[model samples]
Target: MSVIDDAIVWLNDPLNWTNPDGIISRTGEHLWISAAAVALGCAVAWPLGVWMGHVGRGGAAVVTVTNLSRAVPTVALLTIFPLTAIGFGPKAIILALSLFAIPPLLANAYLGVREVDPEVRDAGRGMGLSAWQLLRKVELPLAVPYLANGFRIAAVQVVATATLAAFVNGGGLGMIISRGFGLGLASGGGQVLAGGMLVALLCLTIEGVLALIEKALLPKSLRRVKHRPPASVADALPAGS
Candidate 1:
């Protein structure tokens, strides 16, 4: 049979999914590791990015971080962690993936806050809104879409990359591919193909779900509406007259 045909057969086999080391179990591991990593990345990136963008500084810092993240291959980190205090296992994978997740999150958050209409900021300031009040009431609401998009990008990247956990005995879907390779090409090609297909499918599923959520929360009309400061601010404003 062709590799595709063999992969279909393997995927359909109830036994492959029911065993101790099965698709379901591996997928669970993949999601857990990916979630932990993405959460860690968000925790570190969001506040720093938002602050930098809020104050109109740190553009160079964001670029440097983006470049550094892109320059360092995740797989290299996975291998190197084993030699450090981190040693092996899921923690190492999570740390590496967190680094991988940072650049997009940081870039999007900074850009989002910066993209807020300057007119809106002026309107708020004219009303005597404090910096904290402006950020809380005006900038953050407008930037929600960008923040959501960043999360989607980071999450998708994490889910796809989590497959590498197999390399560190982290027990993710990548283990299936590695095991297949261990069996040699002629014997294991189907398994390798099947594992790859599963990872692709999982990534697509996550992306679609997050996109739908972002759209629902920040619908088109709502996204376009500008934030208006309190009546006190508006009343105090000098008329065009």
Candidate 2:
């Protein structure tokens, strides 16, 4: 049979679709685990990022640590975790993905805050704004765009790295690829290729959705700043004159 025909057969097979020990079910669980991990990572990273940016301290340390974490291979980390822990599953995958997410979030947030114009900050001070008020009203508003961009990046990374979770016997599209590889070894290579293709398609779809969200969430004023005219000489004259 042709490779396409074999893939079609495997995809349509009832065994693959069944939730229990089925490819589809396992993949869904994997996605959920990755999503949860990304959520948790964001929770931990965002506040720390904001605080670091506000204080203008520990930015370098945080970035260095996160970069180091991301540099560690996910598969190697997953493999090592099982040695420490009895089972390999969602927890391992979550830890791995969370480690992967920190650098981008922290770096972007720091850069975002740092990029806020000094003149604007000076203006806020001149207007009798406190440090906290300046940060909230001036800095954060300017930084929001960069913060959102960081989140968009993190989301994509989580989705892509999620497939690796399958290697640890964790669920997701990785399960399909793993199963396909096993079947290929036992029989032929058709199923492996098909499963890998499906995962790629899923990643592409996720990326497109995130891109749309980033565009929608970005501030319109940041994209196009409207300039107000200076006060007129007529208006400057006394009201009773």
Candidate 3:
């Protein structure tokens, strides 16, 4: 049968849809776990990133640590989690993906804050703005685009990496793929491919929605065209001087 036909069959399969045992329940559970991990990662990373960027201190250290955390193989890390201690299910995968998420979130937060123009900051300070006031009124508004971008990236990563949960026997769409692969569907792994495709589509949809949100959140001024200064003499002439 064609791939589409195979996918339809797989989708209609009663065995695939029903939450028999806790295994079937894992799909929803894993998605929840991944979301929680992303949320937790954002909570920790965003503030630290914003602070580092605003203060212009410890950014390199933060980046280094985040990078190092990202570099750790997630599967290996998941494996290292003591099954005896934590058992299986969502905890191990959440820990794994949370670490995976931190680098991008932190990096983006730092980049967002750092990207704010010094002139704007100086103007805020000159207007008698306190540090917190400056952050709230000036830096944060400017940094939001980059921050949102970071969130988008982190969100996609979380969705994709969520599949790794299956290795630990934690559920999600990965369970579908895993089971399909093991069963070797009549269409030659088409079921697994279909399951994987569903995940890809979900990620794409999430990214598109987030991009729209980022666009909405950013100011029109920031969204406007950024033109380079004209060359030399003509550009230097004052408008009315």
TM-score winner among the candidates? 1
lDDT of 1 by residue, 1-241 (tens): 9999889999999989978899998888899999999999999989988998999998777767776777787888988887789877778889889988888888778878998999999999999999999999999888887777778889999998888877767788899999999999798999999999998899999999987887788878545423321111123335651
Quantify how close model 3 is to the true structure by its C-alpha RMSD in Å.
Answer: 8.6
lDDT of 2 by residue, 1-241 (tens): 7777777888788887785867677667756876887788788877777778877887557645754664678888777776666456667678778777776777667766776788988898999999889888988888777677677677778878888877877778777778778666445466776677778887788778876786687767764212211111122245553
How many Å off is the CA of 13 in candidate 2?
A: 3.1
lDDT of each: 0.84, 0.72, 0.73
Candidate closest to the true structure, highest lDDT: 1
Candidate 3 lDDT score relative to the true structure: 0.73
> Residue 157: error of model 1 in Å?
0.7
After superposition, the stretches of candidate 1 with alpha carbons farther than 4 Å from their true spots are 222-241
Query: In model 3, where do residues sit more than 4 Å from their true spots?
Result: 2-4, 18-27, 82-87, 185-188, 224-241
List clashing residue pairs in candidate 3.
27-172
Q: Per-candidate TM vs. native?
A: 0.89, 0.82, 0.81
Least accurate stretch of 10 residues (summed lDDT) in model 1?
227-236
